[model samples]
Target: MKDQIRSFILPGGNIAEIDTREVKACLQALMKREILIAGICAGVDVLDHAGILCDVKSTHFSDADLVTDKNVITARANAYVDFAVEVAKKLNLFASEADLQETINFWKHYQRVQ
Candidate 1:
């Protein structure tokens, strides 16, 4: 499973710091190996701190602009629907537009229910 890791997903949070060497090292390794790294909300700050978003177009919590560069994709906290759909697309998990639309519709319904 470790050898086949295709992506690293960092959940959203109010992270105050991300300078820990170990965490940085892990991110560095992921980038070196071309593993997709995704950060939601404040997690995007972590990626930015790791220098992973140097040239990568990315978005974060409270900022709705979307960014897609290299193997990274980011979106604001409230845009999780878009974020999730983009992530699936990046991973080539959706077989067709219908499949992707279904996912989007599901999430839209979930949001409405909430």
Candidate 2:
């Protein structure tokens, strides 16, 4: 993991310093489309650091231990959805009907590559 971190940093990839221990940075990065974001189990913790979550609704419990700012809607259970919206809010990436349409279009195109 540190090696991966080093590579991204060596390139100075405009990456933000996010606490990966809880998934905050990862989610924020994805919301902004700064980095292609995906994770499982612990990796999702990094997104939590950026104030995001995963398929939280499916789980009644979590092991994450991180936080960003003081206030905002947080993941009650399903973090992926919450995080996506949060990312949109952060980048001003999604808002209104047009914003939703744009997000859907972007995701549809994005998933094709993945």
Candidate 3:
């Protein structure tokens, strides 16, 4: 699973149902290997609580927002387009123009639905 994971995308919402210690440990380990860990909306709280955002500029669902930092990319809610693009870039998943366009199209449809 570790080798298979090029990045970890954390979604937002009330995360009280999550197992923080396990999540933190996993995130730390992934980050140690320089894996891209992205947090969107309240998901940034998990990264923050993990102490992984110590020296990293990050943002959650707040009025003010910071851009990317270290291997972490964060943004507020409703910024899924930026978040997804960042994740794709970090993981080097966009190999061709078609791939990139596909991602854009996906998000465009998603936005319309939302």
Candidate 4:
């Protein structure tokens, strides 16, 4: 199960869901695997509740769009693009630096790809 997962993404939604035993257990399992875990907006609170944000630098709905520390990536409520970009970068999805920059330019900067 854990071995098959490359990353775990928790999207912003009902914060109360985090308190459930099933959610907690799943988070704990992923934490032990040390896989990439991303929490967007209110989702950051979920990660915090899971005790995975300890000693980790994270920004929750802050001025900074995205913050990536170790295997964790966090982002503000309105920073969906930044969050996706950081996760793609962490996963090495781009073939080259130019590809990454192009992606950023097109998505983040809203520039036309040339």
Candidate 5:
């Protein structure tokens, strides 16, 4: 699974369920290998519990929808679309910059992706 995964995306949920020994261990392992880690809303708390946000800048329930620092990506709960777009950008999922803009227009601005 390590080699198969390019990034680890953590979704917001119950803090108790999200922040656990097993999850921390997994996150630590991924961190050691320098895998991109993304967390949204309460999920950012899990990353903090895992000690992944010590030197990294992050955002949670903030005015800014998305924030990326080094290998970490964070966002507020209401910024799921922005979070996804940033992740997609980091992963190079878009064929080109124009493709990315088209996606942003369609998904974020509710415009046609033309």
Candidate 6:
């Protein structure tokens, strides 16, 4: 489901709907300073679980509050969109215009799913 959106939103950006099971390998790529991302919902959970959001302030859907896992980015929503703009704004700070263009193209491609 999410990959469909990722494919459309990132056209030529090498968008990947990496499975949580492979997050360890994914994290290696993410750790590189050049990698920019916008993780949401389970995606956010994966990053938090991996100890990357510890100090970033992201969000999740669980009623239970999160613990200080890898310092965790305290998110503001249970749903993906809640942190979307925030994440995008952050990504824009580093990504190129072409990257954003590809990202939007990917989203436009997937918008039909809803």
TM-score of each: 0.80, 0.26, 0.77, 0.84, 0.88, 0.38
> What is the Cα-based lDDT of residue 96 in candidate 1?
92
lDDT of 3 at 80: 74
User: Candidate 2 lDDT, tens digit per residue, 19-91?
Assistant: 4343454345445543434333343434444444443321114344222232222333335544565545544
Models sorted by lDDT, best on top = 5, 4, 3, 1, 6, 2
- Model 3 weakest lDDT span, ten residues long: 58-67
Model 6: residues >4 Å from true position, as ranges?
A: 1-21, 60-82, 93-114
Cα lDDT of model 1 by residue, 5-112, tens digit: 888877778666554677777987899898989888788878888888876777742245566678988777877878888888989999999998888888778654
Q: What are the per-residue Cα lDDT tens digits for candidate 3 across 1-110?
A: 68988788788899786537999999999889988888888888888888778877777433655368788899888787787787777777899879898888887786
93 Cα displacement, candidate 2 (Å): 3.3
Candidate 2, which segments miss by more than 4 Å at Cα? 1-82, 109-114
How far residue 23's Cα lies from its native spot in candidate 6, in Å, is 2.9
In model 3, state the lDDT of residue 43: 86
| TM-score of model 5 (CA atoms) | 0.88
Q: How big is the positional error of residue 50 in model 3, measured in Å on the Cα after superposition?
A: 0.5
lDDT score at residue 110, model 2, on the 0-100 scale? 69
* RMSD after CA superposition, every candidate: 3.0, 11.6, 3.4, 3.2, 3.2, 10.5
User: Which regions of candidate 1 deviate over 4 angstroms?
Assistant: 16-19, 60-64, 109-114
5 or 6: which has the higher lDDT? 5
Give each model's clash number: 3, 21, 0, 0, 0, 17
Position 43, candidate 6: lDDT: 53
What does candidate 6 score in Cα RMSD to the true structure?
10.5
Please give the CA lDDT of all the candidate structures. 0.79, 0.40, 0.80, 0.84, 0.88, 0.43
Candidate with best TM-score: 5
Q: After superposition, how far is residue 102 of candidate 1 from its true place, in Å?
A: 1.4
